[model samples]
Target: MILHAGVLGLLVGGTVIVALMLFGSLVGVRILRTWNPMSTSEEQLILERQTYLVSVLVAVALWIEIGSALLFIHTVDDLHELFVGAMCATGTLNANPVGWWVLAAKGAIVLLFPIWLAVNGLDQRSGSFPLVRLKYGLLLVLTPLAVADLSLQIAYFGGLQPDIITSCCGALFSESSDTVTGDLAAIPAVLAFPVFLAVSLLFLAAVGWARVSPRPISRIIAAVLSPVTLAVGVVAVISFVSVAYYELPTHHCPFDLFQSGSAFVGYPLMFSLVAAVVLAAMPGALLMVTQHPALRDVAAGSERRWLTGAAAAFTIFLVVAIWPLVFGNLAWESM
Candidate 1:
């Protein structure tokens, strides 16, 4: 009975998440179209309607995929165990040509949505402000987080050894045993020190750059980047420590709180927290800068509004995309 309830919960939750992702994609497409520079008025109207129709289809398809994944998850029992089960299921499905075709089609839809947005949404030049430049800057902020995430993956794959020396030796350390627990405990301390130092230096440099500029806009840019740098730094420190030192209990799943191996909770928490903090800080910083002595002197009324609106829109998008993870109960554990 408990198992059935758990399965149902997963199905409902996963469906909701898929719905959100699809909705976000649709919103992103609309944002892109609104900012599109080259479309004729008639063309824009037609595309807008088409975008809505495609969004509805995407939403329905996402719900179906969620149902499929949930069914698969329930059959497997363990979330981590599902990877192997999925592979076995894939093998069985491969025996049926029709099943293979169906799976392939679903896979294509899942993969294509993001690709479509990246290629089409980014290629066109649009609004007055430099969308590409802002996008690139966002990428820069995101890169470190990506790298840190990759490092966690590597650590997990390598196995949970506490000492860097032993971890390098490729031994599958036990989470329950003293030797393994000690090793896991040491990981966070080892990983965090260097990351924190580097991030702090970067923040100092940004602050210095902002101080040198006499304009409020420059200060505002600095302000926006500063908190982001700090948040990322905090996440990196937490992840570095958590991945290096934590150990899992022998009887329970490795994902449980006591487990040294599961980064599932820590990773998403850090990612969402950092993203949220940076986004929350962006608008106020932009507003303050626009009203500053340097910007006010050089810009006309129209230009100021354009710059402000562009900055606000970009920040809002960032916030909306990551808002679920931060405020909603959809962290790595849920995934």
Candidate 2:
């Protein structure tokens, strides 16, 4: 595993991120303890520069981390050509459970990074805003996870044996198998599709209503529904996207969807869902924003963009996920 190009990339990227984040944690500790935007001291000025500088570095590091995750998957899938028994990424990942675990950890970290950026934005634009320490504290908390994710990546790559006979996607995803994959496959498409659509509509309604009314009541409604929307989004991926990609109700192997033959369509659908959720949830998150002059004006514009982008992405997901079912049904009728 260490010998593979993909594994090397992942290890190198993860190592850099850990180092940067560790440095960030130290800077964050200082910032949290003595962050004073108004003070004209040399230390305050240096701290401000350090904050912005580290933020940029962390942003790049996070992007690299995300790319490393995708690369890891692509690498695993590519190995199928070399392994006689492996047919898809599922087989490669199944060779070592830690492979996907590290991927998942990277994903979680990437998602949370945006929120930290948003919080940092609030603090930067508003000198007196109270979230500085909290944001720094979050950096500290995330550092350990970054370290662990890298360790897991290293362990996974070190342990994976290339020639081992592995259970391919068929066995792993077969509905007859008594596993979580099978349970997800068992979800009735008729019921799941409707539920997914309903949740999406509800999420849209909440965001739109909040935007129009701009009241605490409406904001609260959106905030409460955001998590529900994310949950339904997951169900939709499991029940709808997986089924459509494989064109088989009994096969729900997500990693297999990334195979070259599939044109990697799963990438957009999955990432779009994530983008939509994060963007849709931003307005609700902004409710906690302090009433600072710089933030007040800019926030409105940011919220508008988040709303527009979220709505667009959601629409894309709905269309892409439904196209297969609709066309397949039509072809069935023709047959």
Candidate 3:
């Protein structure tokens, strides 16, 4: 399994990303120690050039990181057939539980990378490069995570064995099971559906308020609600939205959303949610830099765009999530 093309590709790509991150970290250290935007000395000149180079390198790596995250999911899902009783990516993950950690790490990297890029972008917009040190310090902080992502991927893929019989999603997602996922699965659609709808609407309203008013307090409210909405959205998917997708009241495996038979609707559904989360967080994230006069105008302009994007994303999420329930043959009484 480790020799699989997708597996090898991810490993190679991850290796390259880690190497770039390591190099960036070294540059980051130098930047932290000696960055002086106002100085016109040759050393400062060299540092300026290096900062641009490192930024581009890191940006490319982060973009790859996003692609790698999606590929990781596709690869794991593709590998499910090798394990007995395996039906989806969940089974591949069950084959080596560490794969779950790999998934999580990839998710974190994907979420953080865009935020970092946003910060770097805002800094570049300023003549002083005011965020140079902060960006590099963040780079240093992120290097370990990149290293851990690669390491965990190695551990996961290397540990997979054809002989390992994994439990299918049905076993884990069933209400009769004791796991947290089971608890989510157990949540009655009657209850879960309403909760999901309400939370999503509230999130939309908050984001709308921010977009219309463009106040710090409003943006903060939208930002704070964003993650909460994501959490509830996941739970809603597990609880009822997935059932609608599968069209079977008892079949609650969220991983099945990526399967071909479902037209891979999960990809867009998930992308919408993730995009919403990232965009929603940006206004508040910009808040951190807005305290500096140089960033205030930039942040102000960016916040409006962010809030608008976030509102659109959340709306798309709601529409996709409820599509099955509203149009499909699935029914609450089926449960």
For all the candidates, what are their Cα RMSDs to the real structure? Answer: 14.1, 2.7, 1.2
lDDT of 3 by residue, 1-335 (tens): 46898999899999999999999889889888987777889999998888888888899898889889888888889999899989999999999999999988988888888778888888888767888877887888788999999999999999999999899899999999999999999999888878888888888888888878756888788889878888999998889888998899898898999889888878888888998988987777667686688888777777778778887877888898888989989867874
Candidate 2: tens digits of C-alpha lDDT, residues 5-101: 7767778888899988888888888888888967889998888888887687677777877787678778888876655577888877777778778
In model 3, which runs have C-alpha deviations exceeding 4 angstroms? none
Q: What C-alpha lDDT, on a 0 to 100 scale, does residue 265 get in candidate 1? A: 44
Query: Cα RMSD for candidate 2?
Result: 2.7
lDDT-wise, the better of 2 and 3 is 3
The CA lDDT at 94 in model 2 is 77
lDDT of 3 at 311: 79
Instruction: Point out where model 2 deviates above 4 Å.
Output: 82-84, 127-130, 290-294, 329-335
**Cand. 3 Cα-lDDT:** 0.87
Which candidate number has the best TM-score? 3
lDDT per model vs. reference: 0.37, 0.74, 0.87
Each candidate's TM vs. the true structure? 0.31, 0.90, 0.97
Candidates 1 and 2, the one with greater TM-score: 2
Per-residue lDDT of model 1, residues 45-99, tens digit only: 6654554454444445445543543343223223233232222222223222233
